[model samples]
Target chain A: MATVELTFSALPAHVRTARLVATAIARRTGVEESLLDEVRLAVGEACSRAVEAHRLHCPGEPIRIELRDDLGRFEVTVTDSAPSDELEQERELLRFDDPLGQLPDTLMTGFGIAVIVGLADDVQVYPSQKGMRIRMSWPAATNGLSPV
Target chain B: MDLKLDHHSEDRLTIVEVEGEIDVYTAPRLRELLIDLVNKGNFHLLVNMEKVDFLDSTGLGVLVGGLKRVRAHDGSLELVCTQERILKIFRITGLTKVFGIYASVEEAKEAHGRDK
Candidate 1:
């Protein structure tokens, strides 16, 4: 099992760095070449979401990303330390989300969560008391498709 | 990485060539460029995404905004992209139907034949 951790200030600039690092680890972990774009897009969406949350709610907080490869399975978890009072609302949306990947209205436009759910093989979002964590996984190639 | 933007007038419309990744960090620049073009009376806009290596939801949002900006002026905003990787993002976002995506700049211009 190999794991890589990245921590950066909740700035939008760091989102690209997170995506690049995640893609590198995923490629080295035996993920298929065709799905690399998915890996990159999912990581970018998750990180961008976290950065937006932090900028709006908790300035100066740091975002954390973890990339793990185990048994030919690649997984990424992005955490944002931005507090939100709308935890229940978020939970409700995740549960009964209007058609996965369906974008929000222009005024309420936030496409990260929707896009992440669309691209990731498996996704789980946990809203903590002070922050939120999004875990997304993609199955590795030549691994007989062990669910991540 | 950062983004690069360049545009030129070709007979009837303006085509903006975009290069590099478009994310939350870089989407604002694209948005600014689009807004500037629209503000300068260059309403009919065609963005060439052939060199765009990465695009996220933020970038898509910028494109959508640009489209809206042009629509307000009765102008059109289209795209030119051949990369399947980039096109997949459009499909994922349901933007494939929203933007008249073409395989090349020539094809996109031809689509605007009525302008000629």
Candidate 2:
């Protein structure tokens, strides 16, 4: 497994940094230009969501992002330090609240996960030992699978 | 990520040229500018996203908010985007039906003018 890891402060500023690092890794590995934009946007949404989660729950923990290129497929995981159930609560909130979908313009929440789900070829959310892990994968070749 | 926002007037339309990444940190900056512009009675807004290389959900929220703000004043908020990456977000969110998106600033201006 060819892997790259980045751990950064759970700050808004670091979200862009995470995206840039992921873009650099993807480019260096010769990921297609068309897919590079998706990869970058997915990485940003994941990191930004983690940062927001940490701000509300963990407060001071750093976000951990791991990228693994397994053959022609690439996997990126963003780990948050909040409790495992915190993500469940968030998922429920997203379902009920309609953060970006139906909310009034005054509400500025809910677009992160939607964009992540839209861009990532595959998305898996699971509870880790410390908190929760959001794993997103992108295949080098086009897969007909849509975001779930 | 540096965001450069340039404002200009063309054919009585307000055009904002946005360059760089619009994410969590920088979105608020754009939001403030848009809100200020709308509040100042400068509506019929056209945001040119040609140079914006990256945009996240936060940026989308800001745009939606700007749209609503302008609509409240009976004005319009349009987007000038030629990049598929940025357009994908709008399409995924079904915002294409909500905002008028054009290929160029001139097209956006003309479309808004036609509406008036």
Candidate 3:
């Protein structure tokens, strides 16, 4: 088991840095190329959302990212200040009304959240006084274990 | 990322081959490419994505915006996607119905050639 942690002052530039870190971690952990790509996309979406939340609501706050690899399972957790109660409530009530039974394409809605949930095997959200924490995980058993 | 621009006929059709990831970081380049192509009066656009590995919401937004911009000028935009993940994103987002997606660049070229 190996763990890597990084914290940044919630900026747009860190999005690319987070993806690069995930790629390096996946390479070091011997995760498969396809699975790594999935992880990268999932983590990228997660971090981008977190950054957006920080910028919009909790301005000037720091965002933390933790990556953990336990043999075949990889987990990424992003923590940032909680958004306003009104926005959180609004997000909770929002649902995709896709008439075609496909993912919703609402331009200003839960597109990033949908991407994170769809791409990751497990997703957990925890809200505390300190902030909100989002965690996404992938099981190597299902995604293959060969490194790219 | 490399973007190769090709023009067919007297500015009737434009082909842009995008090779790389299309995420938040790279979507600006795509947006610029689309804007440039549209500004040049080459509205019939086909984006060759055979080599693109990944795309995110930002990329999708750019494409959607590009389509709208092209349509505003009475032009059409098509896509040539062979990658499974990219195709899956398009399918999930219902963009396959919004854009003309062909199996290969050659097929897209052929279809566009017929339109000409």
lDDT of 1 by residue, A42-136 (tens): 99988887887888788788899999886657989998887644743653454222322333322123456667888998999887668888898
Worst lDDT run of 10 residues, candidate 2 chain B, spans: B90-99
Scoring model 3 with DockQ, what do you get? 0.26
lDDT of 1 at B55: 88
lDDT of each: 0.81, 0.79, 0.72
Better of 1 and 3 by TM-score: 1
Error of 1 at B89 (Å): 0.9
lDDT of 3 by residue, A1-148 (tens): 5689998877766787898898778666666667777788778877776776777777688888998886577778988885635445545654444322222233422556667777788898675656778898876543334445
Q: Per-residue CA lDDT of candidate 3, range B1-116, in tens?
A: 33333434334667777777777666777888889889988788888888787787667767877888888888888898878888866666567778899997678778877887
Candidate 1: tens digits of C-alpha lDDT, residues B1-116: 57999999987699999999998899999999999999999989999999999988888878888888898899999999999888877776567778889999988888898565
Candidate 3 C-alpha error for residue B25, in Å: 2.1
lDDT of 2 by residue, A29-131 (tens): 6567778999999899888777877887787899999987766777899988877564554455553233324453223334666677888989987765477
